[model samples]
Target: MHKTLDKLYAGIGEAGTGRSGVGELCALAALSANLYTLVCVAPWLDEEYGSAGELRRRIRKVAAALVCRLERETDDLERVRGVNALFVLSNTAAEYEQKMLDLAEPVLGRYEAGRLTAEAALFEAEVCRMMCNCYCLVQDEALAADARTIISGWTAVSPSGTEGLPVGVALARCEAAAAYADYTGDERFRAVRSAGDYGTEEPETICRMLELHLRCGAVSDAEALCDRIEQDAATGTDRTSQVYRLAAKAACELLRIKDAGFSE
Candidate 1:
């Protein structure tokens, strides 16, 4: 048990260079998704299953097509906990960089140099935020320092950056950019608010801003921002408008999307 923890700790250093391709980043992203199950979901398993060995025995009674299972042998809580707690935190930054590079590589290799498309930058921002959450989960926050760097790469501007783009992609970029400034600390909010990259008044942007303000412990400001979104939402009566309203409502609760549960 001691040796296992020692190994996890020793491997905590940054792993790969930030040069992974899109396909490779995609693979790591998938790994992170599965690992998320163990970290976030496994712990919540109803110890109702009894001892770990009994838990394994009961799991074998299932007849569904589920792709995962708790370990079948050992019952050591420390070892079970250590694998999930440490694995992602140890390599989050490296995976973040690779995902960032995957977004940047195409722009660099093609007609543009160093410029990021709104869609690509948005995905990168998502990865950055995901890394921050994962690091925070394990109490290893040093890697979250990448938030500022990641946001800075969002050179794409709305209209210009989002020109001719699908409505879905544009909306997602708004959320991602808003979150980028969010995790960057409050000082960035004003800059991002006024930057008009994804457009400041967007409900998605406003909701994210509200959540950011809440995260910064400014509940009053978040409420004010939520009100502003509600007011601005009167500009349309289309389906998209309705979607924005729903997203705003959900985003108002200071919720963070988490892993899918593995336990019944």
Candidate 2:
């Protein structure tokens, strides 16, 4: 498997440069898809069927080579196309993806050049989906940092290309921001509020904003946001089950806290 990946990488490197033919693009795309398959699908087979131990090991090795290839390709794409590094991560396994993210977090700077789009907020949201769903055990510090970078890159427009994200990406960002604040004891609500790139102002996002305001003791502001949320809900725009339910409960708590003067 490692040898197969090596051949693919070599072919891509050779084909990626000084090439203007469909063959080059097709080869690179095949590598991307195959790499994604290995990263995303093989592990599931191993865990469920236990029929591919040796193949899984080779998959791990392929991941290492893929990381290296991503570095060079990201640089090349950054200078030329701005769309290569992420393809390596595009279809990777959730758990393996988490491990790769954890491994790559320290060296993320190396790939920053390749991730230059200003409308990558949705992409970051996808990252959060993987983190919350599969990499629940990952360290918050790394996740928070990645979120900060991705959010900062976003435009203040509605979130774009969010169809592929988890249903709760916005809410997770709120939790991430709050966690970042708690973890570093620093103010980081900016990332939470930077949901413009999501293309849609999800009910969950509004709820998160309200939650953040309430957490910061901004009673009037939170209440005002609640009014906005209610208006949206009444219009049949805001539709989320778990998040809306949770937000309603949180609102009640905030009301009680305000009445009791728990925070002034």
Candidate 3:
């Protein structure tokens, strides 16, 4: 882990010099994602390296560089890749949510003008999903409404026969619906459940569903999902082990809530 952190630090330093290309920008963005996840799951690393705020500033610098280079990028594919990287960074850096949306305006405009390629459309869906998640986190009602509008627009004209596009759209819709439910205190998980299939295999997706169920007073349903997760964990694969660990954490939280007399 130290070696990986060393590499991330070195890469960030090199990318921060303002001489990096689009490829370097994308690589730095990936590094930022890894760093963000590590800091989240193992916060002790912050004491070992630097404060969380410092790490975030370093990453935000890389994101800024990525956006600057993307402006001069002439290749459609590279521009999309750079923009996607920017979105990934923005997703982790919640403080930059509005700035990220502002940066995405031109891309959204192009999408609205019906000029995006298949790949760009997928990227647009991701942008919407990330922004929705960010807005929900901060409880930004106004921006969340704007995100809903963008998502609705995308869904109305979403292309067919494009592999993975439907799944992307489904996840985006789930995020939007989840946000609405949270803000209004109206349990909308049932509607979101019927929105589309968010893959059950992914631990993060399952955790999200578990959260929605608990929030909507579906304790039995949440427990059933936890049981399924435990069964998958019994398979003994490393991935399943990780899933099981997450499931255990969720179960513990559920127990805590129940013990505190917060009945579903």
Backbone atom clashes (below 3 Å) for every candidate: 0, 10, 0
| Model 2 C-alpha lDDT versus the unseen true structure | 0.41
Pairs that collide, model 1: none
- Per-residue lDDT over 1-264 for candidate 1, one digit per residue giving the tens place of the 0 to 100 score: 224222322221223222322222222222222233333334443242133343232222210001011122122221222222222223333333333233322332331244433345344444444444444443344435554555444433432233454443444333444544444453552233222233466543454455445444555565666667656746555433333444454444222222121111
Window of ten residues with lowest summed lDDT in model 3: 188-197
Model 3: per-residue lDDT, tens digit, 140-227? 6764666566555644553321224455445435544555556546452325432323556655456555555655566766676666
List clashing residue pairs in candidate 2. Answer: 39-93, 40-93, 157-196, 158-196, 158-199, 159-196, 159-197, 159-198, 159-199, 160-197
List where candidate 3 sits over 4 angstroms from the true fold.
12-50, 73-99, 119-124, 130-169, 176-190, 193-264
Q: Which model, 1 or 3, shows the larger TM-score?
A: 3
Q: What is the TM-score of each candidate against the true structure?
A: 0.32, 0.34, 0.48
Pairs clashing within candidate 3: none
TM-score of 3: 0.48
Question: Considering TM-score, where higher is better, how would the candidates rank from best to worst?
Answer: 3, 2, 1
Model 1 / residue 129 / CA error / Å: 1.1
Rank list by lDDT: 3, 2, 1
Q: Candidate 2's residue-wise lDDT over 75-183, tens digit each?
A: 3222121122223333442334544454444234433545534234433444433333222344556655655555444323334322244545554455444544544
